[model samples]
Target: MAEFLSLAEAVRRTLRDGDTVAFEGFTHLIPHAAAHETIRQGIKDLALIRMTPDIIYDQMIGMGLARKVVFSYAGNPGVGLLRRMRDAIENAYPRAIDTVEHSHSAMAQAYEAGAAGLPLAVFRGYKGADLPKVNPDIRFVTCPFTGEQLAAVPAHRPDVTVIHAQKASRKGDVLIEGIIGVQKEAALAAKRVLVTVEEVVPDFRGLHPNLCILPHWTIDAIAVVPGGAHPSYTHGYYARDNKAYLEWDGISADREAFAAWMRDNVLTVGPEIFAERVKGL
Candidate 1:
């Protein structure tokens, strides 16, 4: 059963140093609040896993929490590069983190393989793709049945998985309604799952048809946190805070500016500040 806990408690209890953690959401319902709590707790040496490493991972990486990052595409959505990540990779500012890059298809298949408890994800991909040369983790396997070469990547079985959802019933079943991504696979593949939601209602009985519902049995913790997906948006709750994204380009541009921004915005604030993020919507 999923136990309802505070954001701080959930993050502290669920994550540890050197753990592989996945915070997943496609474009919406990204778990920014949970990521913030992880940063505030000062967890370190994480192998961060995400299909797209956006501002959330950028902030974590900027804090020097990550030792390695595995992802497909990494950048601020609609913005240019992730400046903090660039600083870490290019200049070794704060810390130098190792990166494992893969194709979008490879990542998707890897998550599926993880969810299936498989050792490696195999799919017909990377044909004429040079990613294998640069990423040693990417390998080719010949199918015995078909005699066709296919790409393979190790499954992503994270130590912990965190995601933001639109709502959850008092029973702790999560409801996510929007551009559904691999959050489901990521959560199922992890040893532990923490779901932060905008609100917890009596029951999500009426919100069933279109909403992707994860039964409480699949999750370990539930936290009620409005606007948990800040800079990123929730489907029905608020519009994307494009202003924050644009502003972050400036805030994360320089080392001093990024540190100042983290101190002022993330390190000092609690979960309550999340509600203030989308006041108008």
Candidate 2:
């Protein structure tokens, strides 16, 4: 059964040191509040997984919380590179983070395989791509019928998967709309699931059946966190904070500045402040 809990308590109970954690969102509904809570709690040595890792992952890696990163692409989204991630890989300033690279299609397949309880994701990818030459995990299997070789990679089964959503029912079923990603598969593949939502409604009775709904049984905890996905937008609640994204380039470029900004902003405030942060947007 899903339990309604505070963001702090939910993170504390679900995540542990050296856990494999995935914060899944494409461009929308990124779990920024839960990520901040994890940082504030000082969880360490995480193996973070994502298909497209944006600013939130950069923040976590810069803090030296990640020991390994499994992903297809890493960037600041519309901006340029993720400076912190580049530093970790190139300079190893914070620490040397082991990386496993993949194509977008391969990663999606891996998550689907994990959700289906499969050991490997075999798909048609990496054809003429150089990733297989570098990443030993990228192997090939012979198709029994066609004899055509298919790419194979280990499934991604995270210990805990956290995601932000637009709404949750009182019974704890989560609702996510607009630009859906592999969040559903990631949650199903995880041992534990935590969801932070804009609000909790009475019931989802009248909503369209086709809307994406994660039944209460699938989630372990629900945190009522309005604006939980700040910078990233909820479908109907708020628009994306474009100004914040533009400002982050300068803020994250310098180590001292990043540390100071995080201390003054994220460290000092709780999730409640996020409700106010998105108001002006």
**Most lDDT-accurate candidate:** 2
For candidate 1, the lDDT comes to 0.91
List runs of model 2 lying over 4 Å from the truth.
Answer: none
Q: What local lDDT score does residue 256 receive in model 1, on the 0 to 100 scale? A: 91
Q: After superposition, how far is residue 97 of candidate 1 from its true place, in Å?
A: 0.5
Model 2, range 170-267, lDDT digits (tens) per residue? 99999999998999999999999999999999998878999889999999999999999998898999999988888888888999998998898788
Deviation in Å, model 1, residue 70 alpha carbon: 0.4
lDDT of 1 by residue, 40-63 (tens): 999999999999999999999999
Clashes per candidate (backbone, < 3 Å): 0, 0
Query: Pairing residues by index, what is the TM-score of model 1?
Result: 0.98
